[model samples]
Target: MKKTESISFQDFMNESYKKVKRRSRPYRTFSFVPFSPFAMLDPTILTIGGIVLGVVLIERFLERLGVLDIVDKISSVMRFLFPLTFFGAIIYFLVTF
Candidate 1:
């Protein structure tokens, strides 16, 4: 086995300070989201976010166009489902495990 050089405590600390990460672009941050990739990323979360985004965009567009008063019906359904979704997901996880 090859012998490795041991770093002094002071040398290790100095080396850590010297190493800098250069950012190629500005960081994107979202509220209530963590800076970690693994913490922020989950396939289920991504799918849910995408679905919500599309729904909101479509609703807004339809509202602006004054296509119909369909949003009221959707809002009613949302009010009922919102709470159920939160509680149901927790129950689903519990049952799955």
Candidate 2:
């Protein structure tokens, strides 16, 4: 009888493994100091995070008052009418110029 399934062979089985060969990093020899004390130095990330937080809080507040759906409807209508208004403004600009 022949074996239907055979065990897999590993690539490292032919080579001897090194016990300690991975401590060549530059930080091992040099002292490292961060330029900024804070983890994140850029304030733009904080500003954007604040805007996102504000939007989420306001959306939740509107949803709790049952006004989020109404706001969505108004936004959709405004989106649909945006192109027409944009074209009207372009035409007015061209005529007045």
Give the whole-model CA lDDT for all candidates, comma-separated.
0.66, 0.57
The segments of candidate 1 whose C-alpha lies over 4 angstroms from its true place after superposition are 1-37, 86-97
Q: Model 2: which residue pairs collide?
A: none
Query: Which pairs, if any, clash in model 1?
Result: none
What does each candidate score in C-alpha RMSD? 14.1, 19.1
Worst 10 residues of 2 by lDDT: 11-20
Q: Candidate 2 at 30: error in angstroms? A: 7.0
Estimate the lDDT of model 2. Answer: 0.57
What is the per-residue lDDT of model 2 for residues 1-97, given as tens digits with 9 covering 90 to 100?
A: 9867433355246444333477765654444662344534346444545655665576667778989787686557656665665565446544543
Q: Which segments of model 2 are wrong by more than 4 Å? A: 1-37, 70-97
Residue 28, model 1: Cα distance from true site in angstroms: 36
- What TM-score fits each model? 0.45, 0.34
